[model samples]
Target: MTTAGEAVTASESVTEGESYDFVVVGAGACGLVAALAAREAGKSALVLEKLDEPGGNTTLSTGSVPGAGTRFQREAGIDDSPARMVEDLLRTSGPHEAEELVSWMAESSAEVIEWLVDEHAVGLYLITDYKHVGHSVPRLHAPADRNGANLTADLVRACDRAGVTIRTRTPVAGLLVEADRVAGVTVDPVDGVRHDIRAEAVLLASNGFAASRALLERWIPVMAHTPYHGGAGSTGESIVWAEQLGAALANETAYQAYAAVATEAGDILSWTTVELGAVIVGPDGHRLGDESVGYSAFAEVIASVASESFTIMDQRIYDYVSRNEPRFVKIIDLGCVPEAPDVTALAALIGCDGQTLAGTLAAAAASAAAGTADEFGRTDLAGNGLQAPYYVCRTHPALFHTQGGVAVDQHARVVSTSGTPITGLYAGGGVAAGISGRDGAAGYASGNGLSTAVGLGYAAGRHVGR
Candidate 1:
């Protein structure tokens, strides 16, 4: 952790840079969307990506976004509104520092999705089958293949056609301040040269600090020892700079975690298995805490109690989940998991006693069938509990991303600790305080990350460009 006295300077001295209407840091989904939004408003924009690649965690995600009252939802005969979305978000998040931002995001959800689909020509389909985690209704939209890379590719193509200048391998080292207002950023464009790029407004879409062990230990100590499963570029520099500049931070302890990343191959075992009534068992073949808590919240439970475990699901559940996610099907094809014909065979494969496993599953099955409480108090089983022909995969808890950081206003302008917007400064994506409450993963609803990323970015760009 660098102290306030320490300088964020590099050995290379700062030089001059070409100016633009807006300068965006990090070329992930947020930055891309922001630049596009700026271009649409007749403004010149430039995006600086630290890594060689543009997509950060956005490329690694499933690219799901919650859009209430979207055209796709209307076409699919689903009734939803911004009021319903706000209710769902507030119910999941409880109360937080950013309740007003929640309302703004909910109101802008449909606009953001429609803007991307219509003007930017990004392909998005409404997910009508099932809602995951905290949503009261199905409102998430994703790419056809449910791959984030495809979404990133589309964003890149749109940015290219829109004439947005993206400079990869360029990292912002520090912000340039003049008269207590952020004017631009100091960047290192490789070859040992630094440039001071001035701009009318700056947007920090550089994501969060999940990859930083120091920040994780400082905030969420429970997850400090777990392996981080997010983009490598997220080292907390943006948050650090913003804090040093007097920006207030919130929800620092809240983060998104996965309960079931493959132990052997280190791949994500889709949470759909658990959501569809699969159970996680310890070495003794006993069920863990309520699996209905969803994957992000269950991750903390899995990490604290056991180092490793098996996700046991019946053939019916496996077939149903895999039928939708082709990427998950590839995990099965790679021999990362095993399928067995019966309970005894599955137990042998997972190194558990047959009778013990059978008893463990039977109790849950009885509860699920009765539509009552299970032994672990899980009520919402996606379907009836497992029967013969089961599937099991070895998995462990993993941290995906931090959900909190610098606070921002409705237009994604950075807000100082004094409850005033920091002049000419803006932030979005993981750099901003999230709607997942002040701490813990339990408050996280599905698509909360992208909602903040895309929603705030669009608003910020449109505000600055206009």
Candidate 2:
């Protein structure tokens, strides 16, 4: 007879009150990977996705994950370690409440990458091209396409192979708490019928509350009015359910924002453009604060300075970045990038004074040439200077996702208000407090989201599966 936490076939009918070894809420990378890891440990796992299809905010991302001192990094002749990864992350994020969690993630990053690539056949290659934000080394691993949908699909396929059941259109309404311990979850009303699914352990990987205006206003009010570019499913059911269980929240004000979202194309302009020596200028053709602060941090600068702005890059930079980033290529094909031969023509395009535009470009070029900090304190010019035939795209700032939620332990167990692990309740990804700084978008390093997602997911699964 079937009992709680017993292994079951994927095709078996698990009715209400039946139990799974692990019940994963949300079908993003964190949930999928957690389910896969549980199944790998000879446990029957089930993944519940609120949306009709899988892949939450993870699908909208570039799918790049950072790993320090992996075999892939060794193969690529790069020297790195978990200590260095922690250092890099701490350098970018400053001090945060999740410092211990950051160390845990860094220590497990390489193992997670190896497990995904070697055991599960996830197609990941080390990105040696450029480190991208906040990294002192090239440790990002991504699919050839660098698309999160591909990563999510790979994890889903791996789960399927592992006999893990994934149920879509299944929104979790609340947690099933028994004697102050989570026993399972109550599914939201489905056609007016709700099902109480039980499990030995429950993992909340449902991302964050970026889509909820009320939550945004409550937590990160600075971005409450910003455009939300995150997944619609990020309504923060995890936070709601966990809070009822007395889960202690941490870094609730932190988030990841994108500075250069192409207004016309409705796609991010790829901050790689900025890292390659591009600059964001206001509608008045003046440079915004250091475009090199990384895209998430610069979003606040753009929001404070201009409602609508422009990202200016030359042909060489555009060609280089687009060749590697398929999304950028698509943006170019969509005619989002308009080209001008010189400053005068570019000013005409921006509808700003030519003299002001000329002076801005001239000052930036002088800074790049002298290898000194510009007026905005931007010193890292990846290239010599912006040459003629500049490409300018109208852009705006957008809130990509919330980086904070309920606090979690190193094993991703939800921490109670008393700082104890909430029994049987775990969280990862945007459901947990992030390693990003306690407030604002300035602390986000590239790949921080996915790093936490995959790392904590694996950790949670391993701990619970045992």
- Which candidate number maximizes TM-score? 1
- The sequence of per-residue lDDT tens digits that candidate 2 reaches over residues 1-466 is 2212222222243346668989999999999999999899999998988898899988889899999999999998999999999999899999988889889999999999999999999988899978778899999999887888899889989999999999988887677767778888777534435667888999999998999999888998888888898899998868977887789999889999999999999988888788888988899888889988899988977887688999999988989888888988888899999899998999998999999999998898898999999999999874568999999999999999999999999889999999999889999999999989899999999999998899989999999889
Model 1 score (lDDT): 0.86
Tens-digit lDDT track of model 1 for 222-268: 77888888899988888988899899998888888888888777778
lDDT score for candidate 2 against the true structure: 0.88
lDDT of 1 at 161: 97
Show pairs that collide, candidate 1: none
Candidate 1: regions farther than 4 A off: 1-14
**Worst lDDT window (10 residues) for model 2?**
1-10
RMSD of each: 2.4, 4.2
What number of clashing residue pairs does each candidate have, in the order they appear? 0, 0
What C-alpha lDDT values do all the predictions have?
A: 0.86, 0.88
Query: After superposing candidate 2, which stretches have Cα over 4 Å from the reference?
Result: 1-15, 189-192
